[model samples]
Target chain A: MCVNMDLMATTLPLLDTAVAKCCAEPGSAPLDRDEADAVARLLKAVADPVRLQIISIVRCSEGGEVCACDLPSPLGLAQPTVSHHLKVLVDAGLLERERRGQWAWFSLVPERLELARRALGT
Target chain B: MCVNMDLMATTLPLLDTAVAKCCAEPGSAPLDRDEADAVARLLKAVADPVRLQIISIVRCSEGGEVCACDLPSPLGLAQPTVSHHLKVLVDAGLLERERRGQWAWFSLVPERLELARRALGT
Candidate 1:
């Protein structure tokens, strides 16, 4: 069962592990279950083609934001499909959403990506 | 329909886009379907809790390598389960494996993670 860990900000290791060094030597402690789950959730969010494209669209957008309506046409996907991808990204904390009028604008969260990059055991 | 683009290294975008700048402008071209697929494949490999823990364990090993037989105890998982995760990481180019005697040793692939990092639209 998936736990809604959103509210327990103090408990999640995202911030702590974000700057943690990669495992470079043997005998190091393994990633605990919660740490692995937290990192995996971030990775899963970017594990889809549609989501990756959606992230790229939002990240590339000038003014650091893109409207929900502008996403589908460029990717050749349906509106609902695009919206779905956006929600997943938001939930993963990889993107931020702001509602303006009738449209939702999305922006990339570089810190989240950086945390994932560091987690790669690099 | 996952094509084995492995043999056709010339065709994969892993190299070109690895250095490509993130989409930082609104009118920037979206990531092509192929690029998205390739990046997603890499992400999918690390999108699971078990896989992430496995990666961490292997990465932390000394001499930049870890024996497959030594994995299960630290992670408290079955041997076959740990092996399966190792295989997925190997297939995704995130981990490299070598055989010595009867054991398979796994090591981290920093370059692959670097590419995935750049692909995060960061």
Candidate 2:
């Protein structure tokens, strides 16, 4: 059976705690400490140059997903470094990772990106 | 003479270098190193919990702006600590700082937030 990683991630207890604590429209009112921390964690996940580039590349990929092997060349980083960045993104629920045979394929999590955008009040 | 701090920050040579390099619509194509770095800098500026709260407060303030003196009570932070976060936001061009005789008033720079939103492709 093919399990849906996105749904699984959303339902994970840890992510549920983090994601559920945020998403209040930032411009509508002052965010309390918990809301601010949750939003900040999401922003920090994408606050690195390599990670931002990775997100952009994944966002614009032709098939809507990219294999782990395909990312290093374009990012000009080694496999370990790229994998490290990918792990951070996955942990933050910004990217979904699927195992296809020996390699991992990564895809953007649109809802997470939308949550970050809304947190910015834009 | 009352000068417009937003315009001045937007035109500053250093800020111009950073802000001008990004905003290429992250979903359009892969972002180059410079573009990623620029956008990362902006994200890093607002990646902190205190800074995000400060931005939300200023954005939702009663007069479309807020006095520096009024921030501490809402934030439950010391004046110097709050001021540091304010400086980071101003330096990132995300907030405009205006001097009003004995205090500084902060307001949102809607364009910068929009740029960040676009960079996230939401």
lDDT (tens digit, per residue) of candidate 1 on A1-122: 03434532644455356326344456666677777777777788888988877777766666777889898888898998888888888877788889999998888788877776776654
* Candidate 2 C-alpha lDDT tens digits along A1-122: 12445644544544334434333343456776766776787889999999988887886677778899998898899999999999889877889999999999999898888877766774
TM-scores of chain A, one for each prediction: 0.82, 0.77
Q: What is the TM-score of each candidate against the true structure?
A: 0.85, 0.81
Clash-forming residue pairs, model 2? none
- Name the top TM-score candidate: 1
* Residue pairs in collision within model 1: A25-B60, A26-B61, A26-B62, A60-B23, A60-B25, A61-B26, A62-B25, A62-B26
DockQ for all candidate structures vs. native: 0.66, 0.47
lDDT of 2 at B69: 99
Worst 10 residues of 1 chain A by lDDT: A1-10
Query: After superposition, which runs of candidate 1 have C-alpha atoms over 4 Å from their true positions?
Result: A1-11, A18-27, B1-11, B18-27
lDDT of 2 at A61: 72
- Per residue, candidate 2 scores C-alpha lDDT tens digits across B1-122 of 12435544444544344443333343455777766877788888888889988887876666778999999998999999999899889887889889999999999898888777666774
Candidate 2, residue B114: how far the Cα is off, in Å: 0.6
Q: What is the TM-score of chain B in candidate 2?
A: 0.77
